[model samples]
Target: MTVATARAHPNIALVKYWGKADAASNLPATGSLSMTLDIFPTTTTVRIVDRDLDRVVFNGAEREGTVRDRVVRFLDHVRLLAGREDRAEVITENTVPSAAGLASSASGFAALAQAASTAYGLALDDRSLSRLARRGSGSAARSVIPRFAVWHAGSDEQSFAEPVQAPPIEMVIATVDAREKAVSSRDAMQRTAMTSPFYPAWVTSTAQTLESALEACRSGDLERLGRITETNALRMHAAIQGSDPSIRYLTPRSWAIFDAVAQLRGEGVLAWATADAGPNVCVISPPEHTAAVAERIGALADVVIARPGPGVRLQETDA
Candidate 1:
């Protein structure tokens, strides 16, 4: 059979989900809100193969070890859903900086889910696709939709993501360090969940922020939305930092960008910084300030301005 191809863009969480209630199921402890970026994406192709095991290639290199094993396991999901235990040949290309708090895995798994399901002849709706993607990577659930999407914490059937009806916002992503994080997001999340004394506090605070964020989005109040995004991300990182032995993803450069954001704010630019489990910072701002935000952030590190991107797209499929 010919390959099925899909493309999906990475997402930056505004209302972040830093811990999981069910790690095995990739179920979050709380819902997350995110904005899909048009700048970086993962393009994946999946084809049922004749081999006994799955064959996986990433970025033109054939992956091995734990990475290959994980990819094959993710492919097994599609096999089970199709009721055909066929191994697949999977190829993925990630444009986003790997493990740099850019949500590369979100795009990777979302593309895989869309391509693999179609290749296996399973016609899945957006909700079903989002649920399936979350099995591989929790944040992937939000990447299934473009603009703004919220991934709810619920049972497998009920926890899928739906898009927010709001104006698309631009984000200036500054790469403080393009190198992959020493600690993976999965490992860091689990450790923080186990050791952080403030985990519960964050969950409670995030619930309120989620509501306010949604309202801000609906009202086209970019300042409030930016504030919510920045504060929510800081709350998530605080929980991580308070863990035993701690995990600090932010660097001096990351904080420098934060200073730049504050400066930009005082200058009447509404840029606000948010980060995930890495040193990179994403500054949410109105489109008019995007170039200025990027220029200001560019002083500290590489910067890219991204607009709202499209959801996962099945580009090609063959029976």
Candidate 2:
């Protein structure tokens, strides 16, 4: 059988997804929007054959247990739709920094959904593939599209619809701490959902933030997007504080980078900081302001500034 492949790039949420309403369904506790990155993403290839073996390889290493199980679940879903249960060999490669809270799972699962469905000859649309990807991670649903994407917290089956339009916006993600985090997004959200007293408040506030951010995007107002995103991230962090046996993801360096951004803003640089469930910060600015943002960030610490780019799509081998 010929191998069918798909590639998906990861997205860093400007309005971060912190908690979950339904963990089993991977539904977010709140709706969120993200900017797909240019450099960091995952590529996956799947080949189906009439064999008894099911296999998966990640970056040349054979995987088993949870990772393998998740792939099988995705493939199984594809099989049901295609009306054939052919065994598949799955391979994935990540160009992003792993376990650094840079949305590795978002790109990873999105690629898998695209690759597996395509391999099985399922002519799934982006929305269909997004729903499949959401089964693996809530944020992954948004990574399936490029530019700006939103994950609406509606019904599990009806949620991952593609937007009719997206704004021209750009974000630069700065890796404050590119190391394995003590709390994974899954575990952190699970704990927050069950334990945090302010979880309800966070949800209500998230709706407001989502509306404001969407308006900002539509207006092509980067300043408005920046302010709303920064505020939303801070509120998400507050929810963590309200969690019992309180947990925090921000490192000193993370705050240092944040403070530097603030300082630059004070100096008239058009930049703002937003964070997810981890320490890394994503700075949002207009395309014209990206160089100024990068120079400002460079002074704070060693960081990479990615300009606004297209969403996840298949790469041409020769191009």
Candidate 3:
């Protein structure tokens, strides 16, 4: 028997990945750039055992249902890659709020990919490991890389994440609601792509936005980076709203936070807001302005200040 433990941090996308190119392969429809946050990491430990079915213990409870099914499927993929059929005992924990648009799945699957592959005796490099993580969650690919990372949109072989150079920044997370969202991002994205008239325009525009955002990162222009981040997030939500059923992730409180962020900028603060497929808003600001940003946003919602964080890493291994 073998066991391994790994940890990874959740990332907030600067240029969001809103849809899928291929559903079966779980390939993203657009490229994305993100900064792995220093807060709310997930740790997972995988232990190979002599059993027919994989079992999962999440946050100290034996999990069954969709969460357990997802973990088991991910482990099954790892087993296939390693050419092994042994079941595993998977124990995972997260500090991040799950299914609330805070990207808890990104860190969770990243840590799982690292621990399961190692415990299953698969000697994979970072890129291959990132590809493996993507099979669990597309954003997990970026979480496998440190600090600023970008996930490419292409064929399975070409679509993976890699580290990129960027100017230093901090994120102030305003948690308006930490509970699980009503609709999963996977379901929302698929509905948007298939039904929304704005979906095609979103895909094309995001590709262009990603390029400009990448240039902003390279040139050390935080203002340009922040502007692109806010615009891209708004555009993503617009596409979601255009869906036939009108998927709404951001609520009144979320927009209230955005309004406050805009007011801060009006007062000469370099602050900008971005949100994922959830109601919580993350305000990105320069290092010097992080304290003020956090303080102001804290008045409205619970706040967590974060900086760039490391990628997935093995904490322990035993055989």
lDDT of 1 by residue, 51-132 (tens): 8888889999999998898788887777888888888899899899998889999999999999988888889999999999
192-276 in candidate 3: lDDT tens per residue? 9999999999999999999999999999999999999999999999999999999898999899999999999999999999999
lDDT of prediction 3: 0.93
Return the TM-score for each candidate structure. Answer: 0.97, 0.93, 0.98
Model 2 stretches astray by more than 4 angstroms: 164-168, 315-319
Instruction: Highest TM-score: give the candidate number.
Output: 3
- Ordered by lDDT, highest first, the candidates read 3, 1, 2
Worst 10 residues of 1 by lDDT: 165-174
Residue 175's lDDT in candidate 2: 79
Q: If both were scored by TM-score, which would come out higher, candidate 2 or candidate 3?
A: 3
lDDT of 3 at 5: 96
Best by lDDT: 3
Which regions of candidate 1 deviate over 4 angstroms? 317-319
